[model samples]
Target: MATLSEIETWLHDRLPALLAEYEVPGAAVGVSFGGEVIDHAAGVLSKATGVEATADSVFQIGSITKVWTTTLVMQLVDEGKVELDAPLRDYLTEFVLADDAAAAEITVRQLLSHTSGFEGDIFNETGKGDDAVEKYLATLAEVTQLFPPGEMFSYNNAAFTVLGRLIEVLRDKPFDACLREYLFTPLGLKHAATDPYEAILHRAAVGHIRPTPEAEPVPAPVWALNRSMAAAGAMLAMQPRDLLAFAQLHLDSGKAADGTQVLSAASVEAMQEPQVKVPALGLMGDSWGLGWELFDWAGTKVIGHDGGTIGQGAFLRVVPEHGLAVTLLTNGGDLIDLYRTVVGHVVKELAGLELPALPTPPAAPVQVEVDRFLGTYSCEVADVTIRQDEDGKVWLDQTPKGIFAELGAKPEPVELVGRDEQSLIALKPENGFHSPHVFLGDDGTGRALYIHSGRAMRRAPA
Candidate 1:
C-alpha cells in the first residue's frame, strides 16, 4: 500500500488539473484508512483572492446531511423509541397527506428509504423559522402521493421533513438539538450542526456558480434553511475532515476511535442495504439504501452519497471491505462531475485497486433517410436544430452554446428512468452546446424542450 504521504502528494499534484478543467474554485478533501484519518486539506479556497484552503474550512454538504438524519432515526429505532415499520402518523399526528388514508400508511422506514411518495421538496414559501415548518407540516393535507407507499422508489424530501418532525415530537427538542445530542456530540463532530440560524461568517467556504462562458464565476448567497426544511438539506458548515470522521465511524460499525458506540453495527449495515433498485446513471449502477447509495465499483460494494446546494458540491464514498473512505467538499456547482474521478484516483493510488470501467454504450447503427430528423425544432424552453452529418449520424445543434451529436449511429428514444421522474437513455450525448432536448409529438416532427434550466422559446416559422 502507498504511504499516506505519497497519496497526499499525488492528490495535491492532480487535483489542481481537475479544478482547472472543471472550473471549480476550491475544495476540501479527506481520506481515512484502517480506522485512522490519513489525509486532510483545503485546496484553492478562494479563486478571487488566491487564498489557500485549509483543513478546517466549512462547506455546505447538501444531501450528505441525509445520512446523519437517517442514522439518528435508526438510533431511535434501536432503542425502541420509534418503530421503523410503524406508520409515521403514529408519532406525528400533524402528518396529513392529500389522501389521509394513504398518508397514514407511510412509515419511518419508508420515509428514509424514499418510498413515501410525498412530493420531493416543499421549501417554505412562507419563509424560515419554526412557524414555517409547522405551517408546512399542517399543509401536508394538500400533499398528494406520487405512488403507493413503499410500492416504488421516489426521492421525496417532504418525507424526510416528517421524520425530523417525529424526532421533535419524541424528544421534545428541536431537530438540531436532537442531532447534536445523539450523533454529533457522540462522535465529537464539533463543526457539524443542522442549525442554520447560528452565525457562520468565518470558517465557511462561499458557494460559487459558473453561470456562463464569459462571465466570472459568481458567489451564490449563503443559503439558510427555514427550520421547517432543515432535515431535507439544511445541515451546513463542515470541514471535509469532520465529514470523513463520520464516515470512518460508520465504516468502523459506529464505534468512535475511543471505543464509544455511536451507532449499532446492525444499524450501520441496515443503512447500506439496498432497499430499492435504481436505474443506471452513466457508468454508475443505482440502488438506494436508507439514505445512502449502494453501487459496485470493481465488484467491491462501495456505498456513499453526493450532495448539491446553490454553490456547493460534496461527495462521500466508502469501501467497507477495504475499510477505506474518501470525502470531497467543493464550493462550486460542478463538484457533481468530479466525484467518480476523484474517488477512483484515490482508491487506485492508496490501495492499488482499479474501479470497473463504465460499460460502453452500444454504438449507433447505420442510418438511412436522416433528413426527416433534420431542420430546426423549438419548444417552450429553447430551440434545437437537428442536422445530418456526412457520416449519416444526426447531431443536435443547441442554442446558448454547445452541440450534442446523437450517441451511436442509431438514436435511442429517450425513456423515463427511476422514481425521481428524470428522463435518460443509454449513449445520450450532452455538451455545452447541446440542450436537454425532449422530443415532442409523433412522426418525429415535434419540438425539443429543455427540461429544467432553459429559457422559454417558440418554434420559428418553417
Candidate 2:
C-alpha cells in the first residue's frame, strides 16, 4: 500500500496539471483514511476572475446532499419518530401525488432508496422563501407515476425534497435550518454552505460550461440552482474536507466528533444494506441502499454517491471495510475522467481495488434492434427522443425543460452505438465521457417503456 505521505506528494504535484489537461476551471479532492483527512486543490475557482482554488474552496456537492437528507430522516428513525417501512402519508399526511393510490402506499424506505417510481426530476421555481421547500410539495400534484411505488429502482431528486419536507414537518423548521441544527452543527463543519448567501462567505467556485462541444469552458451564467431543491442537491457547497468529515461520521457509525450519537448504528448499517438492484443502465451504481450508491469494486464493497448541478459535479466514495473515503468536487470540465483519475488511484493503491471502467463504443459498430427504441420518452426535466435514419445510425436527442432551461441547458443530440440488445453507448462524448442509454420494460406496442440515463423517462404516447 502507498503511504499517506506518498499519496499527498503525488496529488500536490499532479492535481494542477490534471485540471489543465481536463479543462476543469477548479476542483478539490479530500481523502480520509486511518482517522486523518488530507485534501488538495488546483486551478482557478472561476476563469473570469482567476481566483486560485485553495484547500478551503467550497464547491457544490449536488445530489450528494441526498445522503445528508437521508441522514436526517434516519435521525428521526433513531428518535422513534419515523419508521422506514411505514407509508410516507402516515407521517406527512399532506403528501399527495397524481396517483393517489400509489401515493398512499409509498413507504419511507422507497423514498430513501429512490424507488418511489414517480417522475423525479421536477425542479420548479418556488422563489427564495423559507417556504420554498414546502411549496415544492404542491408541485407534485400532477407528477406522473412512472411505476407503482416501490416497484423498482429509479433515481428520484423530487423524492428527496419530499423527504426534506417530511423532516421539516417533524422538526418544525425549514430544511436549511434543520440541516444546520441537526447535522452541520453537531458534526462541527466549518466551511459547509447551504445556499448562495453562505457560499459567498467563502472562496466559492463558479461552475464552467462549454458553449459547444469543442469550445473552452466559460463561467456559468448562474451561481446555483434554486433554493427550493436544496435537499435534492440543487445548492449545497462545502470544501471537500468538510464533506469527508460527514463521511467519517458514517464510517464511525453516525457518531459525531463530539461523540454525539447523531444516528443509531443500526440505521447506519441499514443505509449501507442493498435495498434494490438498479437497472442494467451503466449510468449509476449496481444497486442502492437507503441513500448510498452500492458498488462492487471487484467484490470489494464500496458505498458512495455522485451529484451534478448546473455545470458543477461532485463524486464521493467510501470504503467502510478499509475505513477510507474520498471526495472530488469540480466546477465543470470532464468530471468523470478527473474522478476516475483521482478516486480510482486512491482506491487502487490504497484499498487495492479497481473502479469499473466506463463504457466505450465498440471498434466496429454492431447492428441493433433500433425499431424497439424509436420513440420519445418524457420526464419533467427533459424529453429524450430516439430515432434511426437511412444509414441505420441510431440517435438520441435530448431537450431540456423547466429549471434546466433557465440555467442555459440546450438541446443535445448524440449518435448511439449498440452496447447490447437493450442498451447503447453514445458515439460522441459529452464532457469527455460517453453516456450510456438503456431500454427497460415494454410499453405493450413492442416499444421501450422507459429510456434510462440515470433517471428513467417513460415512453410518450403517440
Candidate 3:
C-alpha cells in the first residue's frame, strides 16, 4: 500500500488531466484510510456556468443513498422497534402488490436485501408532498411480481422506497426528516443536502447528460429526480468529505467521530453479512448484504455500493480489513471508466487490491441459437427486445419509455455476443461499458423468464 502523502500527491497531479481526457464536467473524490480522510476535486461544475469545482463542492450521490436509508432502518432494529425478518405487512398494513400472497409474505429483510421479488424499477412520481412515500407505496399495488418472495436476487429501487415508507411509520416523520435527524445531525455532516431545496445553498454540481450518445455531455435539464423516491436514491447530494465521514461511521461500527454511538454495533455487523447471491452480473457484487454490496476481490471481502441518477454517478468502496474506504462522485462522461481509474487507483494504493474484471465480448466466438431469447422484456424505464436479423446476427433493441423518455432517452441497438448458454455480452459498449445480460427462470411457458441487466426485466407474455 502507498503512503497517504504519496496517494494525495498523485491525485493532485493527475485528476485535472484525467477529467479533460475523459471529457467529464466535474468530479470529487475522497478517501478514508488509517483513520484519516483526504479528498480532491477538478473541472467545471457546469459548462453552462463555468464555475470551477472545489474539494467541498457537493454532487449527487444518487443511489448510494441506499446505504444511508439502510442505516436509518437498522437504527430501528437497534431500538427493538422493528424485527428484521418479520413480514412488512405487520408494520405497514396497507402494503399490497399485484400478488397479494407474495405481498403478505414479504419481510423487512427481503426489502433490505432486495429479495422481495416484485418489479422494483417503478419510479412513480407520487407528488412533492410529505405523503410522497406513502402514496408511492400505493402505486406498488399494481406492480407485478418478478419472482416469489425470497426467491432470488434483483436490484430493487421500489423495495427501498417501501422501506422508506416503513421508516416514516416507525419514526413518525417524513423520509427526508428521518435522514436529517438520524444520520446528518448524528454524524455532524455539514455539506450533505437531502433535496434540491437544500442543495441550492451549497456549491452544488449539476448533473450533465448527452442528448445523443455521440455528443459531448451538456448540463442535464434537471438536477434531481422527484422526491417521492428520495429514499430509493432520488435526491441526496454531498461533498466527498462528508460522504467519507459517513463511511468512517461504518468503519468504527456505528460510532461517530465524537465517539457517539449513533448506530448499534450488532446492526453494523449484520449489514455486512451476505444475505443473497446476485445473478452472475459482473458490474455488481457477487452477493448483497442487508444494504451493502459485498464484493469478493480474489478472496478478500470488500464492502461497497455504486449509484447512478440523471447522468450523475457515485461510487463508494470500503476495505474494512485495512480500515479504509474511498468514494468518487462525477456528473458525467465515461463514469464507469473514471470510477475504475479513480477508485480503482485508491483501492490498489491503500489496500493492495484490484477492481474485479468485468466481462466483455470474446475475441473469437461460435454463434449459437438465439430463438430462446427472442422476446420483449418490459420495465418502467425501457422496453428491450431480443431479435436476430436476416443476416443471423442477434442484437438487442432498447426503446426508452416512461421516465426514461421524459429524459430524452433514445432507442438504439447493440449486437449481442454469446458468453455462455444462459448469458450474452454486448458486442459494443454503451455509455462506458457493455452490459452482460443473463437469462434465467421459467416464465410459465418454455421461454426465458427474465433478462437481467443489473435490474431484472421480466419478459412480456407471448
lDDT of 3: 0.89
User: Cα miss at 163, model 3 (Å)?
Assistant: 0.6
Model 3 clash count equals: 0
Ranking, TM-score, top scorer first: 3, 2, 1
lDDT for residue 66 in candidate 2, whole number 0-100 = 96
Query: Please, what is the TM-score per model?
Result: 0.78, 0.98, 0.98
Total residue pair clashes for candidate 2: 0
**Cα lDDT computed for each candidate against the true fold:** 0.65, 0.90, 0.89
Model 3, 1-462: lDDT tens per residue? 798888889899999998888889999989988878889999989999999998999999988889999999999999998999999999999998999999999999999999999988887988989999998888888889988899888889999999999999999999999999989998999999988889889999989998888889999998888888899899899999899999889999899999999998899999999999988878799999998999999998899899888978899988889899999999999888888888888889888899888788778754655777889999877889999899988889998887888888885688898988888888888766878999987776668888987788899876
For every candidate in turn, the CA RMSD to the true structure comes to 7.8, 1.2, 1.1
Better of 1 and 3 by lDDT: 3
Clashing pairs in 1: 128-226, 364-408, 364-409, 364-410, 365-410, 380-457, 401-433, 402-432, 402-433, 403-433
Please give, for residues 246-302, the per-residue lDDT of candidate 1 as tens digits: 888888888977788888899998999898765444332367899887877656788
Candidate 1 has its poorest 10 consecutive residues by lDDT at 401-410
